[model samples]
Target: MEKLHKPKKVFVPGAISPQFIADSIAKHQSKVNIGAHAIFLGQIRADEKAEGFVTGIEYSAYEEMAEQTFHEIREDAFSKFDLICMHIYHSIGLVPTGEISLFVFVSSGHRRAAFEASEYIVEQIKTKVPIFGKELVGPAGEYIWKENK
Candidate 1:
């Protein structure tokens, strides 16, 4: 396994704008000799369940732990794959239904590495991070946090 590098910044906040993420990626491109860029956007879904309709989502995280985990993930991605650069951002607090919950972007010198690294970053986020999210449902809604599968 390759050593991981920490991202320049990581935050667990109330909301995030897609434009902000795009801007951040643009800033990182200066030294990136990237020929390919791939991105993954995760949106909150309104799920209809036996109980009722899921209206929105609220996210939370162990920030210190998540950042450390994210740093390791970044380092591993750089060492294992030939990526020029990569970024990951996730929303915290109350994210309205249908809004984006997470964003992962990867850039590389070639198409293959960008695509692969994009997938790797997301998979690592889902399985390794200490972030948690709760699903809010119905008028008298209940909040359900995600459990590891």
Candidate 2:
């Protein structure tokens, strides 16, 4: 019997569209016996803070490190959960406020696994990956890096 390999994790230094994520999920279905799929989309929010009105977000990452970290996270999730399939994507460039910045999708034989895995992926990305984003704000265009705090 052939062993099943995990789905490829994609990293692009460009804009991310919802269509791209949907396509990825569709392609992974053959390896999954999914009865439930859960997705989480993180959008750039315009924050009105003490600094000023947030305009957009510009993202950056330590690509090599981020990729390695993501791969490890994927393996951990597969081993820890009963998920059949999963994918995670995050924008690396400028993303306008209200646009999707991160997307996570998970499929499982049942709803509970799907839901829990989806949450786990997002949390891992935020804490483990070297990706960071700067919140562009104010009429004069100031930028501040966003931290987990």
Candidate 3:
């Protein structure tokens, strides 16, 4: 297992690209012990709202606090699950509809642990992290602060 305490870079400037995700998975090919990897991608949706349809999402956060909370969530996941490693990335700026905003990848020796831990990590991030999203709802740039459900 890798070292646990080092803080990882979790924030990307915009949408999480497919190339980035492919590269991440490619890099893990050397870890033969990892039998399964669970990945969760959060994509921005073009949902019709009272104002208009959502065009995109602009994400912002208190960087320091968000990073700390992410680290805490990582630690909790490590302690609670039989994980080999995990990675998480979230968008910081504008992500257009149908683009990825969040990526969560969890690896383990078996499938069940990886799947369950990925779910738990995603739930923790959605509920506990302080990241905020501003939904661009109209063509005229009207927006609303998104609330976590």
Candidate 4:
């Protein structure tokens, strides 16, 4: 695996900030050939559970397997689409409500390919990766493990 693919670091300790996302887009401005860029941001929302309102989420993952899975997904996306570039970031640890936990960016020369590739990568990550999360609910610090449905 080391020779085949050097995995890029994907997990951030906390929430991904708006500034970071803006900075990433700004950095790609020099690549004038890229006509379309699609971005997917997974945000933690305060959902009303049967017990109470879910306040936040604590994410965890089987790191080694997840990294390998991500690499495979990236390769598959590149092979399927005419993409300029793609980057995926997922948050680990605690993320408060209204914060972003996952960021998937895809760039291409055309809009359709960019959109399709982005959606494909995101769905693959959600279903294929070994990442797990627990929904932190109520005022008493109770939590319920979440499934990637």
Model 4 stretches astray by more than 4 angstroms: 1-6
| RMSD of every prediction | 2.2, 3.2, 2.1, 1.9
lDDT of each: 0.79, 0.80, 0.94, 0.90
Per-residue CA lDDT of model 1 for 1-149, tens digit only, reads 45545355666476668778768777866765778888898887788866677787787888888888888888888887898778778888888777777888888889999988888888998899888878887778888765444
After TM-score superposition, the amount by which residue 144's alpha carbon in candidate 3 deviates from its true location, in angstroms, is 0.7
Q: Ten consecutive residues with minimal summed lDDT in candidate 2?
A: 1-10
In Å, residue 111's CA in model 2 sits off its true spot by 0.6
TM-score list, all predictions: 0.87, 0.86, 0.96, 0.94
Q: Model 3, 139: alpha-carbon shift in Å? A: 1.6
- Candidate 3 wrong stretches, greater than 4 Å: 1-3
Writing each residue's lDDT as its tens digit, candidate 3 over 33-61 gives: 99999999999999899899999999999
Between candidates 2 and 3, name the one with more favorable lDDT: 3
List, residue by residue over 1-149, the lDDT tens digit for candidate 2: 22245446557655678788778777866865679999998887788967898888888888878887888888888887898777877788888887888888888899998888888888888888898888888888888887664
lDDT by residue (tens digit), candidate 4, 75-133: 88888899998889999999999999999999999999999999999999988999999
Error of 1 at 69 (Å): 0.4
Best by lDDT: 3
Report the backbone clash tally of model 4.
Answer: 0
The lDDT, on a scale of 0 to 1, for candidate 4 is: 0.90
